[model samples]
Target: METPPKTDIAAALNRVLLTRKERLRSKNHWAGLAKIPTTTVLDAFKGSNSTIDTLTKLAEGAGMTLAELLAHGDPDWEVQVKIRNTFRSWTIEDVDGLIRLLERRSGPRDSDAS
Candidate 1:
């Protein structure tokens, strides 16, 4: 799956930080908790000079897992989330049946059979 755009990621992180009851006091607080440099966090918010790993650390400090952060960060996250959730409660048999059904529908039709 495609990573969220940097701007969206920055916005999501800011939203999380701003909305939490236990608000971050400063960039230094976030940097310490996230175990990254303050400049990294600052640069991330500005959508520059931040690696995925650095951003993930900040997300964790903001009380979000990487996936949760991405869910908030990416506008297109819902589709991928829905697709993943679709199989979450399925049994092995259900998956097999789904695969078989898909294969049948997607395979060559009788009219095309040689």
Candidate 2:
């Protein structure tokens, strides 16, 4: 199959940074969290494209995958990405327990909610 269309990396990085500004705060903070160089973060803020490895670290620092970072324009998708990131290191049983607890708090799921 043909590869999916490439996102505009610079634009995507800008969007990610904007969406995460409250947490990331400054280029130095972002670089520290992503374990990348401050200059790289500055370049990204200026709309420069970054290497995949750099992008991956940046995405991780933002609590998301690279794909989620690139496709992060939607508000709902943003929530889902955050939830998925939060759950990434949990055991299946732990996740199931959380789901059950959430279900109890929220009441039964709607038939069409899924």
Collision pairs in model 2: none
Show the colliding residue pairs in model 1: none
Q: In each prediction, how many residue pairs overlap at the backbone (N, C-alpha, C within less than 3 A)? A: 0, 0
Q: lDDT value for candidate 2? A: 0.77
Each model's lDDT: 0.72, 0.77
lDDT of 2 by residue, 5-73 (tens): 566666666677787899877668888999998898788767676788888888898777787887764
Write the residue-wise lDDT of candidate 1 on 18-40 in tens digits: 65537566677888889888888
Please identify model 2 stretches exceeding 4 Å from their true place. Answer: 1-5, 73-114
Cα displacement (angstroms), candidate 2, residue 56, comes to: 0.5
Where does the lowest 10-residue lDDT sum fall in candidate 2?
Answer: 72-81
